[model samples]
Target: MTTILVPYHQDERLLDDEIPVSADITVRSQVPDGDAWQRMAGVCSATAAAVSPVVAAGGIPVVLSGDCMVAGGTVAGVQRAGVNPAVVWFDAHGDVHTLQTSTSGYLGGLSLRLLNGAHPDRYADAIGLRPVPAERTVLVDARDLDPAEVEYLAVSATRRIPVSEVSADTVPSGPLVLHIDVDVIDSGEVPGLRFPVPNGPSTDAVLAACGRLFATDRVVAFDVACPWSRTDDEGQRNIRTQLLSRLAALAHPG
Candidate 1:
């Protein structure tokens, strides 16, 4: 199948290189433009608009994003394509924070929680996105959640698994929108992240898991979020290089 690359490009003054692909869809904004929520309203709106038509036309979508909030747009696009979507969020933290609860005030930190509707509908409605019931979602490799996020997750219905268990057998069935934040892997292994967690899975382990998960034919679309700086040259240990290898594990896209 033809892969339509969706690059969520942003010049946050953090990246060390230009976006590698000529994006079929691009999400760009400056850091001072607005808060994280306002920024996502725009990013995901553009993402959904650009990606919805491509997905509806039977093309496979491969999202290369600057951060995890891209999940908002991916979910919206899959639904716009007339596909029922279950989500698999792979990250170092449980993107579950409310305006009242988050101390750091990082909006992207609320991605999965936002997807699950912890906040108002306005943010989601902006992109024509619907909330996925926590029951239909799985969160894997989130080893560094905040106190509020942890409390919410404790009561939430979303299934949580370790990075080691994120394989085909452990994931939910049916059409899926897979979200992989590169930080889900061990900080030591990847070495360059805006937010890195200790004791996360190895790149090799995650790749192996992704191989099986993708082979299931459940992934309709996927987003690979890279917070790793472009300048961090780690030879074979580069997050971008490792991400590309895992993305190739799928025999085909749904």
Candidate 2:
């Protein structure tokens, strides 16, 4: 499998060497200040277009982005490639909201719900993305959620596995897109994150879960949301090394 590296800077200028390996494609945004929701929509659409060709050629996109919302575009790209891959969302936030449900009005927060086809969003429809069934979708380690988000999940069919229960077997079948929100790791253990939640899983635990998922040989795409790369990168380097090594392993046959 040919794996392409993509760094989604989300506007911050980070060099390739800052990460453990160089990226084949570097994605940066320069949208004028406007509606946050619209900006997010724009990113998803652009992400879909950028990776569509790679997906069509059967190359896996190893994307490093800033926010959980990027999954929408990742799903769109996979659809464009002729596969409706399931999404395994790993985030500290529920990310399953509607425009009405979100109190903070963070556009990316409702990414999962949006992808589930709850909207009349012109951009999503324009990108030709389909929704993943709740039964096929999994949201892992969302230790933090708003009241509305909690209420939505209570009645929703989406299967959720806490950090403690995440395992190779817990994830839905392969030909899957696995999204890892770096903030899902304990804030104390990790840094340079935009949002940090307490009492989350350890880095080792997250890596173990990822290992199990990758070992299944079912994962079709991977996303690591690293919104910011801080100057002090001792912690970041450790994470970068582990993730790159794991991705490299995925590319080569066992």
Candidate 3:
């Protein structure tokens, strides 16, 4: 397995130390002359390029990025490798908001939605990412959701479930792209989360759920999104390091 590190929160590059030190490949954004959408396209394109060949060679790629939006690139890369994969998205908040519904207009909030055929002009189409169908995309542990997100999920074909319910029987059929945002763990357990949601699952529980999915051996890509503030404290950095190591271990367990 190759670890691809993209140390950026959207277009803004994160601190150098924000990513795990085990990176085999580091993606650098090459923004073209255009608007915000075009810049994001360039970033996602860079990530996709790093992810494709690894999957084609039958190796699972573990992508570590600063935010969930990079997931579009992971999916695109898998598709480029000729595998049509379902998506299992695990996060604290529902990443299903569109530009119209989002009050803060945060692009990260629309990550999953864009993967399910939203805003093709700016996102999916820009990077040549074929959107996964709603039924094939599952959102896990979205405990903190906006009213608009809730409404969309209620009517949308996408399946929503808790972290404890993630297993082979519940997930979409065929190959999968597992996208886990570290914030899914209880905010109290993970320090410096930029968008903390209290009263979530424990770190152990989250790992256990991930273990179940990895055991299936049908996961094509493991994408980890660390949407947290940079920490100077050694204790906090240690916690983050431990968590990332555990996550990487899941994809290559002996």
Q: Candidate 2 lDDT, tens digit per residue, 29-143?
A: 4443556555566666677776778778877777766566677778888888888788888888888878788788666676788778877464467446787888778999888
Q: Tell me the lDDT of model 2 at 6.
A: 41
TM-score, each model? 0.85, 0.82, 0.98
Q: What clash count does candidate 3 reach?
A: 0
Which pairs of residues collide in model 1?
Answer: none
Q: How close is each model in CA RMSD to the real structure?
A: 3.3, 3.3, 0.9
Q: Which stretches of candidate 3 lie over 4 Å from their true place?
A: none
lDDT, candidate 1, at 154:
93
CA lDDT, every model vs. true structure: 0.71, 0.71, 0.93
- Tens-place lDDT per residue, model 1, 1-254, is 43334444332423323224434445554334675456567777767766677679876577777777777787888898898788888888888888889899777777787788767564777667888889889999788978888898899999999867777767777888888887888888765577889887887787777766777877778777876655535563445664554564453434
Q: Pairs clashing in candidate 3?
A: none
Top-scoring candidate (TM-score): 3
What is the C-alpha local distance difference test score of candidate 3?
Answer: 0.93
Clash counts for the predictions, in order: 0, 3, 0
TM-score: model 3 vs. ground truth: 0.98
Candidate 3 lDDT, 1-254, residue by residue in tens: 69999888987778768865579999988885687788788889999999999999999999999999999999999999999999999999999999999998899999999999899999999998999999999999999999999999999999999988999999998999999999999999999999999999999999999899989999999999999998889999999999999999999886
The positional error of residue 143 in candidate 2, measured at the CA in angstroms, is: 1.0
Candidates sorted on lDDT, descending: 3, 1, 2
Highest lDDT: give the candidate number: 3
